[model samples]
Target: MSTAAAPAPPGDPALLTGAGARALFRAGLDTDTVGWAAASAQANLIAVPRADAYDLLLFAQRNPQACPLLDVTDAGSPATALAAGADLRTDLPAYRIWRDGEVVEEVADATPYWRSDMVAFLIGCSLTFETALLEAGVPVRHLEEGVIDPMYVTDRPTRGAGALSGPLVVSMRPVPAHQVAEAVRITDRYPDVHGAPVHVGDPAGLGIADLGRPDFGDAVTVGGDVPVFWACGVTTQAVVAASRLELAITHVPGRMFITDVPHTAYRR
Candidate 1:
């Protein structure tokens, strides 16, 4: 299955939810339309043969913070259990075709790379909390500015699992001083989705020297707000880049699988 890239998806994003958002992606939006999860990111996906699935699972379980497994596709299938009728190969707007830890191609549809041996894992994304934060009166500056959230590689090291290990990656948001506490309380409820701020107020604490420049995604104005940091799923890409597996595929950083599962399903 495949989707053709359109200049833009029709109608309004405010009216789109769940499957409607999935449909917009399946229709082949550009690589930049990261509205599905508010700001989807890289995922822990494997295209290796079934014989190696066990290793991947071990890696995922060992490093849950960076690679929280949401749903894993049955061997050879592009459809995930997380979203019915969702074709993993096409539903996401962008994909990174990897070879030896290198991105060989970036494409809108990944049907050309689909393999019977592949298993795609849908990890919980922090972006899912954007809706909650907005409802709670926290402004998502990136959404307002129409850009992906700023992501950074931190001095923190992620726990190693099998061959997957890398530095912690984080996404940053400028929350107003008064709302920072509320943001934490609100996100603290969704542990499955990288809940709560790993670090707050000072980006320097995370070894991020310049907030204006991020290792991944786009930067937004910090203004009068405090920079709040959260664990980001993009750390998986850091592992992919570090491990340099012979052949693999992942959602391009900031391009994620939008699952049918509600963000609240992860509240704890």
Candidate 2:
């Protein structure tokens, strides 16, 4: 007898509610959350020991564009104010286990590695605004290709906070040249989700040599659309690796925590 897990059904992910997406992830549906729950917000997860939580908090405050703070959980707690009854260890589609600056394991469930001293930080994610871009007639290439958006490590360095410091990371999207202004205007309202384009036009200005390759996530075709860049919460992962913390946990790049909070809540 064969015993294989079933795959997630084909449908518009945007149709799922935040809690619905969490339940699917908890049930072992591992996939990126782009376009999921279009009306809700999404977040990047980073958990560190209680002793290092302050450093992470300071880091976010210093680099709001790259690490916008959303909701944080108390030490040893999996609960978050952003999502009622969501388990931090099991609610996300995937988690990365880090040790001494290296990713040691990628797992569907993080319960085994979660420690009582761990404090989880939920940082705002740019994926939350892709829906807005689509509604405004700005194309999001990765979503159309059904892949995670590409993220690049730029020449820009973020401000240091305590022991945490690293270069800024940005996620790229190909926006129609004429619609670039509309894309920026729509996203700028959601400051909590890495709002607005940090750079546009030439990738070299940010020291990115090739759009074909990215530091994280998959590369999508840019074609005639201009490449638009936005500060990404994955900057936290870079900081974690650079700081060489003994242990850390973060969401796999692109697989985000779908928050119950609506996108409108952050739109200004």
lDDT by residue (tens digit), candidate 2, 1-268: 9655845844887888899989889888998887888889999999999999999899999999999999889999999999999999999999999999899999999999989999999999998887778877778899889889999999999999999888999999998889989998999999999999999999999999999999999999999899999999999899888889889999999899999999889888
Model 2's alpha-carbon lDDT is 0.92
Clashes within 3 Å, all models in order: 0, 0
lDDT tens per residue, model 1, 1-268: 8745474765555445656666776776755544554333323344555655666677768767656777777888987777778788888778888887888998877888887888776777777778789888999899888888999999998777676667889999999999999999998887777877899988889999999999989999999999999888777777777877766777776766766676677767
RMSD of each candidate relative to the true structure: 3.0, 1.6
Model 2 weakest 10-residue run by lDDT: 2-11
Which residue pairs in candidate 1 collide? none
Name model 2 segments beyond 4 Å from true. 1-7
Candidate 1's C-alpha lDDT? 0.76
Against the hidden reference, what TM-scores do the models get?
A: 0.89, 0.96
